[model samples]
Target: MLEHLDRMEAHLRELLEKEGGWLPFERFMHEALYAPGLGYYTAGSRKLATPTDSAGSSDFITAPELSPWFGATLSTPVADVLRDTNSLDVLEVGAGTGALAASLLPALAELGLPVNYYILEVSADLRERQQQTLAAWEPQVRWLDRLPERFRGCVLGNELLDAMPVRLFCWSQELEVLERGVVWHDHGWTWHDVPADSALSRIVRERMPPLPGYLSEVNLQAEGWMHGLGDWLEAGAALLIDYGFPQHEYYHPQRHRGTLMCHFRHQASDDPLKLVGLQDITAHIDFTAMADAAHASGLEVLGYTSQAAFLLDAGLLEHLQSLRESDAHAYVLQLNSVQKLIQESEMGELFKVLAVGREAAVPRGFRRDRLHSL
Candidate 1:
C-alpha cells in the first residue's frame, strides 16, 4: 500500500510540474480519485462493506450494503418508471459492490418485471467485485464502459453526485473571490489560493454571498452530467440519491466552512491533502443547482424529497411486514438496518432523493415529495 501511494504521489507531482507548479483543486481531486491505475477508486482497495463485514477494513458503507431492503424498496419506484415509459431496462451508474443490483433484480422479478439491468462503472476493481456478487443474474446484467448513444430506461445513482469533482472558492468581504489549488512546498502538498478566473468568479458571485472568509464548493461537473443525461435519456427517469441541501440551505450564512469531507477507514475528516490517493473526498450537493441544470437541458424536475419519505412512500413498512412473516431470524436482523436507514438522526433526513425525467411519469415514490423545498 505504501509503494502504491508513493507512485500515486509521484504521478501527482509530475502533473503539478506540467501545470506550472499550481494545479486546480478540481483537477487534483479528479486525478486523486480516478487517475488511471493509481487513484483511490482506480487502484486495488477494499472500499465498500457493511459494518459487520468491514471489521475496520473498509473506508465506508453505503445504503445498499447496510440493508438489502434499501434496494428492494427502491424497486417500487423503478418499476413505476419502467411501466410509465414503456421500457424494459434499468441503468445504474457507479454501482458500488453490486449490492443494490443483487437485491433489486430479485425484487423486480418478484414484481413480474424481470428486465435487462445495466451498470456503468469506472472502477475495474469494483466491476470485478460486482461480477462476483451478481453472478446469479449473469447475462441479464451487463456492464458498460460509457454511456450508450441512446437509452430508454430508469437510471439510478446512489450516493453518486457527491463524488464528482468540485471547484473550491473562498469569498471575502471585499468582494474578492479566490480559487483553491494544490501546490507542493516543503516536500508536502498544500493549498494555494489564486484569483478566481472569469467563469468561476461569475458563478460564485451569482450563487453565493460575499461574506467574510466564506468557503464553499461549486459542482460544475455535476451540472455537465445533468446536461449529458438530457442528451441520451430519450424516454425515462433518473433517480439520484445522496446527502445534500437545497440552494437556500446549502449556501446559508451559517454554512461558512462548506461541506467538503474526507473518509478513511470509517473515520471522517476535513483534510484531503493528508491522504492523497488513499481516502475518499466528497462534497454535499446543491439540489437547486442540479434541478436548474436539468431544466436547462430540457428535462423536467419530477420529484425531490428526503430519503426517509421516499422509502416510506415506496412501501418500506410493507416490505418489513412481509419479511417478518417469511423469516423470523432475517426479520430480526433487518429491522436494525431499517432503523438506521430511516431514523432522522441517521441517513433519513440528511440524505435526499431527486428525480429528473423526460416523457416519464412522476414515480409513486414521490407521492409525498417535497419538491417545493427545492
Candidate 2:
C-alpha cells in the first residue's frame, strides 16, 4: 500500500508541477481512486470486510458487505422491476467483492427468476474479485466493460456515487467563493484557493446562506454520471444507496465544513490530503441534485427514503424472522446487525436510498416514500 501511495504521490507531484503547482481537488481525488491499477478500488485491496467478521480487516464495510440480509432485502425491488418490466437483465455498477450479487442472484433464483446478471465495474482488480466471488453462478452472471447498449431491468449501486470526484469550495460572509485545490508547500500538500467558477459562485451566493469560513462540496460529477446513465437507460429503474441528505439539508447553514469525509481502516477523518491512495475519500450525496439530473435527462423519481424505511418496506424484518434459528446467541447477533442497519441512531438514519426510473412503476419498497423531501 505504501508503495502504491508513493507511486501515486510521485505521479501527482509531476502532474501538479506541470499544471503550475495547482490541481483541482477533484482531479487529485479522481486519480487517487481511479488512476488505473494504483488507485484504491483498482489496486485490489480487501476494502470490504463484514463489520463482525474476524477473518479479515478492511478500510470500511458498505451495507452490502456487512450482511447478506441487506442484499436479500434489496432483491425484492430488483425482482419487482425484472418481472414488471419483462426484462431479463440486471446491471450492477461498482460491485465490490460481488457480495450483493452473490446474495441477490440466489434469492432471485429461488423464485425461479433466472435473469442475466451483468456487472459494470470499472476497477479491473475488483472486477476479478467479483468474478471470483460469484464463480459458483458463472453461467448466469457476466461482466460488462460498458453499459449494454440500451439496458433494461434494474440498475443498482451501493455506496457508489459518493466516491465520484467532487469539487470543493469555501464561502465567506463577504460572499466570496474560493475553489479549493491542491498545492505542494514546503514539505507536503496543502489547500490552494482561487476564484471559483462564476456559475458555482452564483449557486453558493444564492443557495447557501452566509456562514463565515464555511467549506462544502459540489457533486457535479455525480449529476453528470446520472445524466449519462439516464441517457443510456432505455428502460427500468436505478436504485442508489448511500449516506446523504436532500439539497436543503445538504447545504444547511449549520453544515459549515460540508459532508466530505475520508475513511482509513474503519477510522474516519477530514484529511484526504494525507492518505493519498490508501484511504477512501467521499462526500455525502445531494439527492436533489441527482434526482434533478435524472429528471432533466428524462426519468421519474420512483422514491426517496431512509435506508430503514426502504428496508422495512422491502420486508427486512420478515426476512429476519425467517433467519431465526434454535441457537439464541447467533440469532441475537443477527438481530444486532439488523438494528445497526435500521435503527435511527445507527446506519438507518445516516444512510438513504433513492430510486429513479423510466417506464417503471413506483417501486415495491417505495410504497410510502418521501420523494417530496428530495
Candidate 3:
C-alpha cells in the first residue's frame, strides 16, 4: 500500500504539473478513484468485511456490508418497480464488494421474481470480489463495462452518488464564486482555488445567492448519470440511496468547510488531500440538484425519504420477524445491525433514499413523499 501511495502521489503530481499546476477538484477526484490502477477504488484495497473481518480491516462498512437485511429490505421496493414496469432487469451501478447484489438476487428470486441482475462496476479488483461473492448466483448475474445504450426496469445504487466526482464551488462574502482545485504545497497536496467556471458559476450564483462563505459540493456527474438514465430508461425508476441533504440545508451558513469527507480504516475525517489514493474521498449528495437534473432530462420524481422511513415502509420489520428466534447468535447479530440500520443516531437519518422513476409509483420507502424537501 505504501508503494502504491508513492506511485499515486507521483501520478497526481504529473497531473498537476500538466494542468498548469492547478487541477479542478472533480478531475483530481476522478483520477484518485478511477486513475487506471493507482486510484483508491481501482487499486483493490480491502474495502469490505468478511467472516474474519477486523475492526480496522476496511475503510468503512456500508449499509449492505452491515447486514444482508439491508438488501433484503431493498428487494421490496425493487420488486415493486419490477412488477409495476413489467420488467425483469435490474442494473446496479458501483456495486461495492457485491454484498447487496449477492443478498438481493436470492431474495428477489425467492419472491418468485428472478431478476437479470447487471452490475456496472469499474474496479477490476471489486469486480473480482463481486464475482467471488456472487459465484453461486452467476447464472443470474452479469457485468457491464459501461452504461447500456438503453435500459428498462430499475436502476439502483447504494451510497453511489456520494462517491461520484463532484465540482466544488464556494460562495464567499465578496460575492465571488470560485472553483476548487488542487496543487502541490510543502511536501503534500493542497487547495488552490480559481475563478468559478462555466455553468457551475451560473448555478452557484442562481442557487446559492448571497451565501457568504459557504462551501459545498455539486455533482454534475450525478446529474449526468440521471440524465442519461432518463434518456434510455423507457420504464421503471432509478433508486439511489446515499448520505446527503437537499440543496437548502446543503449550503447553509454553518457549512463553511463543505461536506468533503475521507474514510480510512473505518475512521472518517474532513480532509480529502492527505492520503490521496489510500482512503475513500466523498461528498454528500445534493438531492435537489439531482432532482432538478432528472426533471430537466424528462424523468419524473417518484419519491424521496430518509433511509429509516424507506426501510420501514418497505417491510424491514417484516423481514426481521421472519428470522429464526432459535438461532440466538445470528438473531442477536441481525437485531443489532437492524437497529443501526434504522436508528437515527447511526445511518438512519444521515442517509437518504431518492427514487426517480417512469411509470413507477412512489417507491415503498418513499410512500410518504418528501420530494417537497428537495
Top of the candidates by lDDT: 1
lDDT of 3: 0.87
Q: Rank order by lDDT, top first?
A: 1, 3, 2
Candidate 1 residue lDDT tens string, 166-252: 999998668799999999999899999899999999988888778878999999999899888998999999999999999989999
TM for every model, in the order presented, reads 0.98, 0.95, 0.96
For lDDT, candidate 1 versus 3, the one ahead is: 1
Order of all candidates by TM-score, from best down to worst?
1, 3, 2
lDDT of 2 at 173: 59
**Model 3 compared with the native: what TM-score?**
0.96
Candidate 2: tens digits of C-alpha lDDT, residues 147-250: 67688899999988998999999975576898899999987899998889898788677667767699998888889988888878888999999999998999
TM-score-superior candidate, 1 or 2: 1
Note the Cα lDDT for every prediction shown.
0.92, 0.86, 0.87
Compared to the true structure, candidate 1 yields what TM-score?
0.98
